[model samples]
Target: MMERKLVFGVAVGVAVGACVVAAVVVGRRVKSRSKWKRVVRVLEEFEVAGDTPVRRLRQVVDAMAVEMHAGLASEGGSKLKMLLTYVDNLPNGSEKGTFYALDLGGTNFRVLRVHLGGQRSLSLEHDVERQPIPEHLMTGTSEDLFDFIASSLKDFVEKADDPDQLVARRKELGFTFSFPVKHASASSGVLIKWTKGFSIEDMVGQDAAESLQQAIDRIGLDMRVSVLINDTLGTLAVGHYQDPDTVAAVIIGTGTNACYLERTDAIIKCQGLLTTSGSMVINMEWGNFWTSHLPRTTYDIDLDVDSPNPNEQGFEKMISGMYLGDIVRRVILRISQESDVLGPASTRLLMPFILRTPSMAAMHEDSSPDLTEVARTLEDILEITDTPLKVRKLVVKICDIVTRRAARLAAAGIVGILKKIGRDGSNGIAGGRSRTDIKLRRTVAIEGSLYTSYTMFREYLHEALVEILGEETAPHVILKATEDGSGIGAALLAASYSS
Candidate 1:
């Protein structure tokens, strides 16, 4: 009888243990499903930032305009003596010479040679080479990195097939120091803080031309750095040289900024520094503008939190090419975590920083008969497979919402600039009775990948501007998408400085 009791107790304990194990397995399955569900939902609803409370949108845009004006008026107003670059001179049709331009922007650098003819034919010839930046060099010493660039320049100069035909004896060249710099004149500037994932400690507070010139000389290249120009300034100069009516130039690539011709008298801080001509170029590092009226969606907030500099460049963080796709990724991740639609056991998205901007761009390029491209882009980027058709459609919709909002916001900012410049009228830049011409009228030069390469971004941006500026005035303001303006513009600036 005692042995029978002992066997029964043992059986009872075994049954309880089995029950606990089963419960745990079921619980884990539920939790895993729940987490993945959130991820899918977030991905599908990547429109978090686009759907920002409408009330906040107005506040963001208004503040943005105010900040835009402030930054433009005072270059290098930042603590680093990074004053606003004053490029008071514009190009006339008579700039004649053989010039070279070196463009050192983010991710890649390019070099070009051109022959400028006066108003006659304006003949131009160019050769360019591209090099990818090693990830390690980004965080390395300034001398190491600049020396690398110098070496590349040396090789380029050496390999020239016919130096006499392409370059002049003096070999003066324009350097498009795309990074922020403190400039005392058109031909000289000091390096300011480096942006775009570059963190070389020694480069800041140094003369950009001196470093580059030394490297050029060390490589046995006889080139004089005649001009040190910012990319935005280069864009404006080149655009204006091509078309005198181009009153403004903007770059919306990996970064965003604007440069416009302004009266030196308009700059209050440079009271004694004004040139005799009373006109100067003002570079509005408009990306730094902070505002509440601009669109501020949930995805934007998340991106800001994850970004190196948060609560800054609120507008740039939203519209620029570099961050646009990243924002979409965050939104998608949020949806996957909260929703149950994506099915269970898909934990690929739960990994941090899985989606990148380029991946988002790939997804955005999706335009299949059945929107299969959208799902394909996601799969290609994240290695996920077998996405449902419903989820794919939802993802496309999310991309549309975010991109449309970005276009609209960009349009509004352009309108604000036109308003500030007194070009919002029929009289145009002519100085007669058009001072109060609060009408949209002027040509703007736009340079950037997303603006130029995106499928419908330019059209959408035009539509958005028309919506805000009204139909009648919209025709007066022409937004021309210009290519390679920065490279040529830097050369134009060099010519101007030399003249």
Candidate 2:
């Protein structure tokens, strides 16, 4: 009797212990669900705040047009720096010559030579050589950097068709300096500041073209730096060379900027602004553009606050490839902090910019039923492990939301340019004619990894354009991607402005 009683007590204790363990497990699951709900609420709020409805996009378009007008009216009238390019005429395929181009924008620099065949030729023949800059030269003196560039150019020229022939005549070259520049002419610009890991202090506030020209002379290479342009102008030049309909160029790569042909009379900032064609390309430094109409979110505000150049390049922070990944990361970080859905290693999400745009794109584009890529990206980049399938879906949703906003905003920017120049279906500020009255075909040249590589981004951008312009007027507008636009276009401009 005693043995049986003892056995009963042990069984009861074991069963009770099991019950308690089961209840604890249930409590944990309930807590997890609550946390998940909180995260979803955050996401929902972000989505609502991030939405750029067609109505709102139109507002953005209008604001952009107004800002452009203000900037063109005076030097300091608005945030948009509508600087003049002094390019009176674009290359019309009548240019026939061998011209050289030097490209210095970021970590790497390139040299390209273009051979044009004139009116009878179908295409321009061009050759390009690219090399990485030594780490030390980026922080070195202005002379050191230019001398390295001049040396590289000299070697490339000697290896080409005729070293003696090249030396026989002064070669015209175009310098595509993709940095902050204040141009004095088509062929001359003062460096505003160095960016992209370059720390050449002496180059600031100096003539970029003159520096290159001096370097060319030092190497005994008789070359003239004919035009100083940014990558956007290069894209424009290349687009026009290929298609005369192209009037504007936009660069949406690691950075974003735009330039368009504007009427000389409209550039009121320059009292006597004159061009042979009555139009000159204006660099709208569109990155600095700002307006209350933009559907800004808390993410944008935080990003701007944390960035090196706060309150600057506001538009870029919201739409550029460089910041897109960071935005997604911030979203995920918020989720991780509020929930255990992503597992125990959530601390890794704290790193800033650890998630690159390319990685975010990979996750977004993953088409597998199980979303293996998304899972792998999370594990690899954020050290997040064993995330549920729904969590992966949530990540995809966040990427879509962020990317769609950027694409739509960029579309509004493009339409704004149209509105400013009377190319938008609607009449200009005066609103005299129907949007359909202007039937001329317009092409916008675009270059960059964002538009060319990201399929979804391109689709969203196109959809927004159609929505903003309506189906009737949207057909007349074309966004053309220019490959090697910067290098080849620079060479073409050199030929057009050749002495």
Pick by lDDT: which candidate is best? 2
Q: Can you tell me which runs of candidate 1 are displaced by over 4 Å?
A: 1-65, 72-83, 106-108, 120-123, 131-155, 158-168, 195-200, 216-222, 351-353, 357-362, 426-441
Q: What is the per-residue lDDT of model 1 for residues 283-363, given as tens digits with 9 covering 90 to 100?
A: 777777655455566667777887788877776887787777766665566665566554453565655456655555556
- The 10-residue segment of model 1 with minimum total lDDT is 75-84
The estimated TM-scores of all candidates read: 0.79, 0.93
lDDT of 2 by residue, 365-453 (tens): 99999899999999888999888899999999999999999999999999999888888878876355575666878999999999999
Alpha carbon lDDT of each predicted model: 0.69, 0.89
Q: Pick the candidate with the highest TM-score.
A: 2
Error of 2 at 477 (Å): 0.7
For candidate 2, give the lDDT: 0.89
